[model samples]
Target chain A: MNRYSLNQATTKYWPLEDVVAASAKAELDWIGLWREPVQEYGVERAAKLVADAGLRVSSLCRGGFFTATDDAERRAKIEDNRRAIDEAATLGTDVLVLVSGGLPAGSRDVDGARAMVTDGLAELAPYAGERGVRLAVEPLHPMFCSDRCVVSSLGGALDLAEQFPADQVGVIVDAYHLWWDADVYRQIARAGDRICSYQVSDWIVPLPADNLLGRGMMGDGAIELRRLREACDAAGYDGPVEVEIFNQQLWDAPGQEVFDLAYQRYTEHVA
Target chain B: MNRYSLNQATTKYWPLEDVVAASAKAELDWIGLWREPVQEYGVERAAKLVADAGLRVSSLCRGGFFTATDDAERRAKIEDNRRAIDEAATLGTDVLVLVSGGLPAGSRDVDGARAMVTDGLAELAPYAGERGVRLAVEPLHPMFCSDRCVVSSLGGALDLAEQFPADQVGVIVDAYHLWWDADVYRQIARAGDRICSYQVSDWIVPLPADNLLGRGMMGDGAIELRRLREACDAAGYDGPVEVEIFNQQLWDAPGQEVFDLAYQRYTEHVA
Candidate 1:
């Protein structure tokens, strides 16, 4: 209960103020936020609202999508990441999650796209570090490797993160994205101090047509959530366990109900 | 053209005899077989049909689904694999590709399920070797990791394969499954002599509702098909380059049309 955080995305329709009020009423110590809603509500005001409610922002939703064919587009994405870093600092959170962009349109050069991620990170890591923000590379599930995040494994994320100082760049271990890997436990051990955030969700089957909404609630699917959480704990990641599910059903439900259900599942399956 | 093999799954509705006759007409040296269709047509007759058409069976579609909660069910699956080995031998193909079953029903113990795969392989490898059939572990994409194949990466498949005699058990290098892996090239190099069959299919975005049929044809998606084929060749595999795509569109098309298009794409994008 002390370490539980309800990521705002789980209840997608929940207003920023409503989520903050709910978290405060629930006596939750942390809440995870997304950039759009934070910016819409005003970053400083959102930060003050959470602080006034005695809650901290676990992380800012995202900051990377650096893969681009055009030089201007690539530069703009990096610049956007710079702004994202500033937003994370403004919101009083140290971690900014990154979903490295997929291959450029009509491109088959995965290695080239990955190289662009490296270049983007190289340019942003120092800037992020200076502002007390850690860029957390969130390796999406390999299914999303083609259209969403090119970083599809924790090992791959660590490969990118290892190029920079641990404080500047780290990896996010989301159970939904990584529970499939046989090497996960070993990689979690390897992650050690580079683990910036630990997210919990289950791997449900027969993914939605739009598979981006395919994540299941913590206790309803196949992931060993508590085991992964314990592994992160053993690896020295003593941080908030954010409940970050992207399911359409949860989004359509009442926000308070979804938040309560997520917290309950977090206790049963993740804590 | 000298190395191309049409996996029967690519032409799902084509009768076994028609596929063999078509391969013969196409001057193809190889054709991959699926067990159910061969069994339906009678294995010996299908074998003779393929041999009569002068098309050697490059590999068998599958021979694994070993995860089972019940001990008796597990034993039956192992026995079924033995029959599959004999079937592969009768078809005169040494490679028997295996899609290790997903986690058992209502089970979250992935490691436990994986142990079942390891144990299943151990029991069947010797039997397969005796029949001159090398069990080829095909690592399905990570999306299939939950409900299709618990062995989700070439590295993970190789981990299981390395525990057995290389002649008895090897890994399949399927481009669609391994393409998204950042460490895939390194893993392919490590596969060396353990490589059994090389399969090609493209990774397309907006995966269909049934992602099992989400594979796109060569030159139609994001995979670097020729590069992967070359990697297999560099790893000392001089076997048939099998085009194994499972797509609803291809299945609905005329068999001859699909076959010819596949060959054209093979020459342009894979060969």
Candidate 2:
């Protein structure tokens, strides 16, 4: 149906209610939201607002940041993920996004961290599965390989997924991250039905300073979106294509203006 | 013995003969050379000069840009690799560095290109193995992901290595491309004596416009060199810690001055 979901981090400077209101006005059927906004206006209040607006929660923005030098921090992250899963379940969202954490502090050991992630995921898998929410490991761009997700490829994510039960693990292929990967096509095919969600954004060359929020909107960058969507279709994916940008500039604009521009761009490019 | 090899491309602007003389005068036991010098001076002449100077060739600079749309073009690359192996044999180099090609013309499919690389490598392995030369896949920076090697992570390179015979496949883990990776230690361990070569360079933050050549000389950038070297040590890697700087400013300096500064920096920080 070419359904669209706006990930609120795209314009996170705006309040959750404002974003929800904008989505409802735009007639977007779904939304991918961050924990920060959900917390700001209590989750209870956020829930009521979503229901009031008649928007489906596509997936939670994220949960996993599992890498840690010590056991205590890792445990804390696991507990946080448990809370995130509960939130997703409460929201009736089918998926909880997981960003595999980057390297631990003062430690150059990545495999150990990856092992730690696998252990953490395996421990958390049962709880997520029991709640009917799958863990969607989102492979971040390789530029973030050290400080962000260690699982930087769809193939790497799928390889990790293979270690657990199919019902328990899947992946979120963020276009901003996956677009630059030369192996995206075959990996997406290999991901096949395990793809829990698909996202849309652009890989802005000469990435803006303050990179965490510098993501460009779809069609503003060089991503081959239709081809990616086609790959998703070729591999039996029929989920909502979410517009999840993290642009500071967009957040400064009026919500109505941002959504209209995003919707138009999504239709022309990503949809 | 803690020996060093000057990769000629580190001072790429210099003439082949001059670069060779500089390496020899610097008292470096070995040198990693490129194809251009050989092409300019003829392989026999270049080989004789390095031999007369009593310097060993640690490895040849490169062999593959195998990714391409045309079938015959791919075949020609394979044939070129064979010639590179022959050149390696004549120059007494033990390895040939291979940069995985970028996206083929008008193509955004990375997996297909990777498959082409894997197939091409499988074909090239036997020829290289027969000549006592090994193919060392050097994963470039993530910026080159769309246009360079599909194997971005050390683990990705390791996975590729697993496909071929023990002596035939290995990787070159450069500090510049991999310093940010959390999995560096574990991947090096898994690389397990499969690490045929190690290249050293530093990453400059606020990347320059000509990112390709604007590398930071060691001690000028953010990498924790000793720890990474320690990981390489723990992984049973006894290969030469080759310095392969690609900085435009450094390139402009006289060859001897660059080598003197490089050795001092390596000893102080990386050794």
Candidate 3:
């Protein structure tokens, strides 16, 4: 319970105020946030709201989609990431998760897209480091490789992150995305202090109509959540264990109920 | 088109007789068969039908699912695999593709399930070799790791296959499954002569309700089909390149129409 944090995505429809209040009421030490809701609630107000409740911001949801074919589009993405870094800084969170965008439209050049991600990170790492924000490269499940994130493995993410200082760039080890890898334990050990965030979500089968919302709550599917959390701890990641699920059924539930269940599952399956 | 083969799964709804006639009429070098249809059409009759038409059976669709918890269930799966090997032998196809089953019911021990796969292969490889069948372990896309196959990468599959003689065991380089892997090129190079079957299919986004049927025709999605085929060729595989797509839209189309479109796409994107 000391390390448990409820990522806002677990209760996506929950209002920012309600989530912050609920986390504090539940006596949680932290809450992970997304960029959109914080901006909507006013970044300063959201920051003060959490600060007033004595809850630290564990991480900011995202700040990358840098793959683009044209120069202007690429520059625009870099600018957007810059704003994301600023938002993370303002929110007082050191971790800004990055889901590097997939291949450009009508393009089969995966190598070219990967290069763009490396370039995006090389440009943004210094800016993020200056603001005390660590850009956490999240390797999405390979299922999302074409349209969501080109970085599809922790090893691949580390390959990109090792190019920069560990404080400037790190990797997010989300169970849902990486539990299927045979080399996951080895990579997790290799990650050591490079693991910026450790997120837990079970891998459920018969992924819904839209696969993006297919993540199951911890202990609800086929992931070894405790094992992975232990692996992170073994690798020296003494950080918040964020429960981040994106299931439609969980979203349809009451926000408080979802939060309570997430906390409970984190206790039993992750923490 | 000398090396082109139309896998029957691309037009699953087509009758076996029609598919055989169409492949012969299209002047294709070979036809890939599924176990169920070949069994239903009578293996001997189907074998004679293809042989009489001057076409060869490039490979058998499948022969694995060995991750059962109960001893009886495990034995049943091994028996089924034995039958599948016999079917492949009768069909005159040297390659028998194996999709290792996922985690056992209510189990999260992926490592344990993988061991079951290795055990299954070790037990069956000699039997398959005696029947002149090479057990080709296919590493399905990781999305299917929890349900359809536990072997989720060429490297993982190789880790299992390398324990057996190259003549008894090999790997399938399916473009749709292995394209997203960052280490795929290196794995393909390591596969070298261990490559038994080369499969091609494009990976389209917004996967359908049943994600299993979401594979698109070659030119309709994100896979670099030509590059993968070249990789297989460079690995010393000059065998038939099978176009194996599992799409609902393509299945609903006329068999000959789907076949013609697949041939064109394979010519432009894979061959």
Q: Which candidate is the best by DockQ?
A: 1
- What would the TM-scores of all predictions be? 0.99, 0.74, 0.98
Candidate 1's displacement at residue B177, Å, is: 0.8
Q: Write the per-residue lDDT of candidate 2 for residues B75-181, one digit (tens) a residue.
A: 88888988998999899887889998877865656667778879878998998898899999888876676656666777777777889986987888788887765
Model 1, range A1-271, lDDT digits (tens) per residue? 4899999998889999899999999999999999998888898999999999999999999989999989999989998999999999998899999999998998889999999999999999999999999999999999888787889999999999999999999999999999999999999999999999999988888899999999999888999989998999999999999989899999999999998888888888878
* Candidate 1 TM-score, C-alpha based: 0.99
How far does residue B242 in candidate 3 sit from its true spot (Å)? 0.3
TM-score of candidate 2 against the unseen true structure: 0.74
RMSD, every candidate, angstroms: 0.9, 5.3, 1.1
- Candidate 2, residues A1-271, lDDT tens digits: the string is 4468888877767788888988888777887788877977777778778988998888887899999888899899999999999988877788888999887865545667678879988999999999999999888876666667677778778878888887788888788787765467888999888888889887665555655665787776657887898898788888888888877788888877887888899888877
lDDT of 1 by residue, B1-271 (tens): 4789999999999888788988899899999999999999999988899998988999998989999989999999999998999999999999999999999999999899889999999999999999999999999998888798999999999999999999999999999999999999999999999998889888888899998999999999999989988988898989899999999999999999999999999999988
Clashing pairs in 1: none
> DockQ of candidate 3?
0.86
Residue A63's lDDT in candidate 3: 88
State the lDDT of candidate 3 residue by residue for A158-230, as single tens digits. 9999999999999999999999999999999999989999998999888999999999988889999999999
- Taken over the whole model, the C-alpha lDDT of each candidate is 0.93, 0.81, 0.93
Q: What's the ranking of the predictions by DockQ, best on top?
A: 1, 3, 2
